[model samples]
Target chain A: MPLSKAQLLAWLGKLDAVYAAKKEYLTDLDAAIGDADHGINMNRGFGKVMEKLPPVADKDIGTILKTVGMTLMSSVGGASGPLYGTFWMKPGMLLGGKEELDAADFARFVEAGVDGILQRGRPERGDKTMYDVWAPVLEVVKARAAAGDDVAAIVDAALPVGEKALADTIPLQARKGRASYLGERSVGHQDPGATSSYYMLETLRDVLHA
Target chain B: MKKLINAVENVVKEQLEGMALAHPELTVAFEPTFIRRADAPVAGKVALISGGGSGHEPMHGGFVGKGMLDGACPGEVFTSPTPDQMYACAKAVDGGAGVLFIVKNYTGDVMNFEAAAELVAADGIKVQNILIDDDVAVKDSLYTAGRRGVGTTVLAEKIVGAAAEAGYDLDACAALCRKVNQYGRSFGVALTSCTVPAAGKPTFDLGEGEVEMGIGIHGEPGTHRMPIGPVDALTAYAAGQIIDDPAYTRTVREWDGSGWAENTLTDAPFAKGDNVIAFVNSMGGTPLSELYAVYRKLDAVCKEKGLTIVRNLIGPYITSLEMQGFSITLLKADDEILKYWDAPVKTPGLVR
Candidate 1:
């Protein structure tokens, strides 16, 4: 499955809704160890992304992502701004001039975005960070694509794993972001970063599969 | 929560706008909070930049004038600034001479600045970063983000900024900042919790009788909590950590019978005749009178130890949002560090 301009816009819209639905859960998790603004920031960031979508619907994939990146950079003032902005920008940089993304191209795009997060955030796998979920999702995506699965199947297979990974973040010790400040007290609380990562991938799945 | 602002979200941007307008000699970047010298893009001079969360006023941004930072980025309240913001500042200030990033030791600030440094390095400008971890608060014991970069950040910024203004290269300036950080140590005690505006409540709950000791400047919990006592005893306890002299505790025990380290002083970090640069800093809500009270006891301890106060910087240099507390810092300085300390500095938060 390849994502069309309309599909991408619909995906962005769906992502906004997903974040809105999960806002309280995310905010509650953040309240335990962070500034308690993860859900609010994501809702606001994706909402802005949605508003910017209609104007750039016909642009190339790279241009769309870069627009999202720059917008989030300015709109979101916290750590979420730079981390998520880097996520969208890296994919855009790799997919520049491409009209649409096939399964392999999209997997590589996600992989590149993960690499950007790792480089920018420097989070290790068990840091109880967004990397905890993203690393596994990126791996699963790469593995399925190499095994010749369709985009729909690969995304479908990855979302559950991503969700599981997010849930697993609750038991791990946090080593980055605001939660890291809590040390042992941060344990037992779900990582807000991991929750947001799940929402992002879920959006990609919806856009490509719908 | 009753802060003076147009909107909670626009606080940093509006403040930077005010800074830009108020000081015609300084330049402020609104999008990502950065303060730069008005006559920036000066060729062949190393550019110095430092930034962290926004609530610590006159900090990185305040110390951005003539003798300090060439540029300073501001993040949201208690949140670190992003990489792109730092990148923009670095690109704007990067003359042919390269740039130095003076970063605090917080994980978020360090990671974000490192990311920006990588991006700037890709553009072929040399970049170096020096992480300031000067708080002598307990480490590896957990409960907070390691040792925070506290009072020493002021000294590092002013000294390193002077070195850069004198045309020193990036590596030399970075080394100078690192040298200052290594020579300095700070410890803070909180009389009350701070109210984060967005949270609209105090960060933590402290009872009427308790005071938090060994706290980071960012409203994080401290190493210990004890009942609030008289100013003299609290000050002497705070000072003893810095002076670390057995004779000082012996003298106090002989005279006042109140010094904290009378029995354990020998095992402490400080010894006699140490040359120190002392600072009595207030958390946002603390008044100068309380700080002076702490300083008074600290001065007595110093006198007994035979330690000399080579220089003293006292004020609210680093703070949480309206937290009622004060910190004491002692920099074991040498001749070179002291000379850099006296260098001229002008910024919104610090003007000397």
Candidate 2:
């Protein structure tokens, strides 16, 4: 089924909830390798974005995504601002002028958004960044959809890949951001950013199934 | 962890509000996170603008009055301000004499500030930049980014800001900033890690009797970890890395991206000067007494080297929000730079 406007908003709302739920755990992970505020920062920023969503609720898909991008950029701190901000903004640009998006268009927009994020942050696959989870999920979603999978199935298929990627972060030495400063100390900790990305994508899956 | 902030996420915005309300003399545009001198468009003075993340308070913002920055931009904690905000600030602070931007040598800060300078230049606002990479922590390292910018930022802003306030043209102000940066070297040590308010915990763990050396102002991990020892020894460890070596001066001159700009000034004396400015800065959690203690040790070091310490400024000028640590910065100065260091300045955090 195509993603209706209500479904899109609902997905964002669920992502916000998932983020709030895992906020402390995320902070715990950050405490080990980074300044340790990724979870709370994302929750607070996404919460603010949700509050400002009502006025723009009736806008097109492009408008909604762009609004999320700008809101996150202003409200989120650290690398998350530019990373997730680019995530939503690029997809928004790809979906420009479209009032609604079908499954294929949604998949294409997601691909474009992920590409933009890669360009902006320059994070590689195993650098223990959010890209670790995001990259796999992007591939899963793209492949599943290409095989004529339903949107909900594609979402479900991608969710586990993201979770697995998040778990895989624990053994990897960080090669990016503040965690990189820790050198060997960065091992044995899941990247807070990657964990949060899993929650984001998982929430996206749940909302589509709902 | 014992900071007075209500919430970690609210710290930056709340501090900005407090700054604006506390200092009515400063023309503050809270929109883009910039603080300009209330008497901003002061006829012929070149505008001096500098900024980084919010935790390093007072370095850029507090110095935005008389002898320092004409405008300051504050980013979120540990994050560089966006280029759009910087371009807007440069435009707002321009006095028709162009602007000099003092940027720390961090990848994000450098890239964003450079973008802002280009954006401002497209509007015909002449802008030059001086990158500060004075912390002698990591040099040509693969594991870490590079040497961080620490306490020297405070001294550079003051001397260059004074030069601008003294009616030096854009080239002269830029030259003055470059000279200060070239002659400056800084090193820091942290006793306890600072907690980012939002995280509600320490950024790093220093065991009860341990200290991290060569730390930066933004709570970044440093080069070495040693058990916490006497204040004097810690001071020596930090100061030894920053001062009393000709090789240190050579490194400073070579690393400065803008050092060559000062070649036009016939009075550029850092390559052959005796006067120096010593600034010891707290890393948020430390007190004034501790800062003074570090300052005294730094002074002794300069004395031992037979180098004249002509000026001294010490305190919590820049901080990282209750991180129990301090950094020592030394800027080899000249007669002209010394005059500007004594100029009157009034702002919320620094009033003298």
- Best DockQ among the predictions, by candidate number: 1
Which docking class does model 2 fall in?
A: incorrect
lDDT of 1 by residue, B1-352 (tens): 6778777778778888888889988988765567888888788989998999888887878788787888998887887787878999999888778888888877667667766776778788888877776666645413334456888898888888888888888778866876787677777889998876666777778999999888876677776899999988787777766555221111101011121111211123455677888888888888888788887778887888777887887788888878888888887777878787787878887777
Give chain A TM for each model in order: 0.94, 0.95
What DockQ does each candidate score versus the true complex, computed on alpha carbons?
A: 0.28, 0.18
Query: For residues A1-210, what per-residue lDDT tens digits would candidate 1 score against the true structure?
Result: 666656666777888899888887887788787777678778777888878877888889889988887677555556677777788888988888888778898798888888878766667888898889999999899999999887778889999999999999999888776566567878898888888888888887767755
Model 2: per-residue Cα lDDT over B1-352, one tens digit each: 5778887657888887788888887877866677788888777779888988877877678778877788888887777776667777888878899888888866456545655675677788878877776777754324443456667788888777777877899888877777777678888889988876655667777899899987887777888898888888999877777654334322221112322221221112233336678888888779999888887777787777666788787788878877898888778776777788788766666666
Candidate 1: segments with Cα more than 4 A from true spot: A20-24, A51-56, B141-145, B236-272, B302-307
Real contacts retained, model 2? 0.11
Residue pair clashes in candidate 1: none
**Cα lDDT tens digits for candidate 2, A131-208:** 888888888888888888877788888888888888999999887676776778899998888877777777777788
RMSD of 1: 8.2
Q: What is the lDDT of candidate 1?
A: 0.77
